[model samples]
Target: MAIHIIDEANRCLNCKKPKCMEGCPVHTPVPHIIQLFKEHQVMDAGRELFENNPMSLICSIVCNHEMQCAGNCVLGKKGSPVHFSSIETYISDMYLDRMKVKTAEQKKQNVAVIGAGPARMTVAVILAQNGYQVTIFEQQDKIGGIKQYGIPEFRLPKTILSRYQKKLLELGIRIRPNTAIGTTLTIEDLLRDGYASVFVGTGVWKARNLGIPGECLANVHFGIDYLANPSAYSLGEKVAVIGMGNAAMDVARTALRNGAHQVTMYARGRRIAASSHEMAYAELDGAEFVFGKAIERITEKGPVFKTSIMDENNRVTGYEEGEEQTEADSTIIAISQGPRNRLIRTTVGLEGSDKGLLIVDENHMTTRKGIFAAGDVVTGSKTVVHAVEAAKKAAEAMMRYMEKEGA
Candidate 1:
């Protein structure tokens, strides 16, 4: 089974200098882990991956392989790139069945991480491993922020998220759900209470609203709200997604999954520029796209909505122009952008952009010393892996600061 899997894994030319690792935000050891699996050392492979990424299992299933590790594989130059994700998943599954040993001794530094999302989870794990008592404060009742709420069941099952949460608990990281940082307990309280340091990883949950006329109509809703409460609205037979980004793709695909007869995506950019690889997968899954156009307005017509499209110059380019007004049970706006600013302002004294994203330095540190921010909050919006990577960097920086102060 191992040899068959190895041969089937697609041989890597194994570039003299591997670019695959460079392409990964978390810098996972791609080729080495694959080689370990190829050699039938599945447990070793799992250990290798775990050393770099705590969320490997979740990522192996959901990551955009085309844009990351596998996309940069030199083997792609010949025919197909190595099936890194599949191989990684296989190794992870095998190791998960066995009893793996912990490699580090626990220490005693108290660290508080805000937001139970990917970035905060990563920081919590690393801090715990380094002998720190890590406590995560999440406003939501559950640990996984967007992963639990924003993403749908089909792509990322709740079971997978629950499993990761279980792992974090086993690692000695404390998760305080239903606890909002700025609301339940302020940063000053955490500091005064003797936390050595606090890392903020609250993701961007605020949806960007379409400023066009008629957006506030009862028939219109933001994608986040729609995904957050799928049972609340009766999705009409036809629906239109107002963006071509991944979130837009997610909204469109989700609409289709919920029984919408037709789903269309509107993008102001070309297909290549607007859609991500995951979005392309969404396209293959039956979401249609109308590239290079923007929705100008939405007007409710009984149970339907009439939408107008505009060109780059803001002139009316097209519409359901004369076509029977499409009955839209709900017009979803997937274009809102922002980080949770209240926490940032209260904790770190950092200002957000007009768009509400936190400003950060190259080290992923905010303007406030001893405080760092990452993930969607810092990058505006990005993939889960990107958030994990940013969190890892922030954790390392925080560790260095703690060490300096201790020394």
Candidate 2:
């Protein structure tokens, strides 16, 4: 089912010096893993990937290949790059059933991870592997965060995500879903309860508003809200999505999937305007685009909504300016933004940006000692791989700090 590996593994010049590894964020050994796959050592290949990334399954599906790993492949300079992502996917799928690697059970220290997202999960896994008893407090009823709720099943299947999650549970990571850290339980409380360190990975769930007039109208909704609860509302015959980012594309594609007759994505920028590669797939799924135009206003006319558009400099432009109102039954706002900092406000000595993401040092340590933050809560919405990298960094830093304190 994976495309990259099925195509490229056989074509690998098996370069003596592979540039693909050099381009990876965590520098995963690409050539060696491919060699293992070619040799039918699928489990070994999966283990090699797991050595650098615990969220390999999720990354395989969501990674921006054209930008990372495969993008830098020397083979790509001449021909199609090795299908590294598909190969990685195949390795995970074929071997995950046989490999029974569990977290090391040494019980050396205690760490409290907030939010059950990728960052929290990664920190918990690393800490657990090092014999640290880790407790994860998640605000939601389930783990996986946006991956479970935000990403559609068509893109990321729940079975793959569940398998990856099961490995964490086998590692003895304690996940307490429906428990919020800065609210239901404070950081001070976690420390008082004997946690050596606390890592926060609460992601940005609050959607950004367009601040236009008709936003307060009945059918206008945040793209996340629609994606998060698809069955609640009918996407109807026509829909206008307000942004060109991945989320906006998801909304448009989702609308099409839900049987919407037409879906149009509006962006103030050009066609290359999308922030991620997933958006390209969404375009291929039949989502239309209205680029280089911004929505000025949305007014309701009878049962439909009229959206006015303008150029970057506020000059009237788009179909709405020429007596052709962009009529849609529903308007989905997909402008990207940050989290609600209600929790960070209660923590002493902790500060956030004006945009409301928690500020942390290179080690992911907050201004407050014993507190570290990662993932979207700290980085303002990043990829699963980035969150895993941050979590690994934070876990190592926490371990060093604990050793220094003689904990």
Candidate 3:
């Protein structure tokens, strides 16, 4: 059963400014939605939320609410603020089954949405509802890009993603799975055929490597490779994870659950890059952390690190003389991610950053006309909420472009 709505709804306070909304990346209407839930307008509340984010429940689960919406609550100044995201999530999960999304009767224009990730999914949902015939093209056989591949089952199960997929199909959005944009079909092919606009949300799947010795050892794995295919290989007992972010923590916890006896994480900086809650959970999960150590080299036996302090400039300072070695059968690097430019290189006139991130104007339009890009592909690795915000902005811009250049 869902939590009691009355107690939480009554605590909203419904301020005129609503700093919760202001702090939100997608600007979710917390106060107004709470007001609707308070009045027993259950379906109406969900609809109002979908008006902004189609994936409200998923966001509620993954989002760091204590840092964003709940952080800015006025009542938090005096006491504990209303758990807005949690309340919204409970109400949404309850009402989603009862509510049916009403899409446009007529589907006229066609828009090609590349990658079935969060950004593109948001774009497809918004465009399809507005009478644009949206078709999604995913390189992988399955949908839900990072949500399906990177996020663990404990965090977000595949069953929840399937529900979102069903809604998109019902909204008149078509999809072509196992079809890559560059290898199978190029963006020009879609434009030449009938698609009025092309939106690229293909995120970074390539993981960065630690340019050190013995990197080609047998059990080495990139963070994405390990997460994307859990059954690919046995991580083995005594695993070493490199980095200090959410991905690193997730990898450590995942390895621990997968029968790895001990998972230890190493970071160059003393500060934890991931959310404090996640780090706490990792610690509880029996994962060890060694900070202020830089990996000197990765030998077949394990990784050798040099103890040091990271300066304000991120340079190695206070370098210790001796080397510290951690014995491990496997090493998982979760350092960073760079954009894959295979598709962008094939599509002429689409400019990108030196880092290979797709370059876009204020309107989310790429260098090439009629082409737009968003998500991690456009801005490197960022939050899902930031990607959704960019995609929505792109959707609005496409709507204007569609009108100006009639399909």
Q: After superposition on all CA atoms, how large is the RMSD of candidate 1?
A: 3.6
Winner by lDDT:
3
List the candidates ranked by TM-score, beginning with the highest. 3, 2, 1
- Per-model CA lDDT versus the true structure: 0.75, 0.78, 0.86
Candidate 3 regions exceeding 4 Å error are 4-6, 105-107, 310-316
Q: Worst ten-residue run, lDDT, model 3?
A: 1-10
Q: Write the per-residue lDDT of candidate 2 for residues 322-373, one digit (tens) a residue.
A: 3335778888888886797867777888889888998998888898998888
* Model 1, runs deviating above 4 Å: 1-5, 96-106, 272-277, 302-327
**Model 3 lDDT tens row, 65-112:** 767788899999899888887678877787666567777665567999
lDDT of 3 at 284: 96
For candidate 2, what is the lDDT? 0.78
TM-score of each predicted structure versus truth: 0.88, 0.91, 0.95
lDDT tens digits by residue: candidate 1, 238-300:
787777766777788888888888887776545333336676678788988765454567768
Winner of 1 and 2 under lDDT: 2
| Evaluation by lDDT, superior candidate among 2 and 3 | 3
Which residue pairs does candidate 3 place in steric collision?
A: none
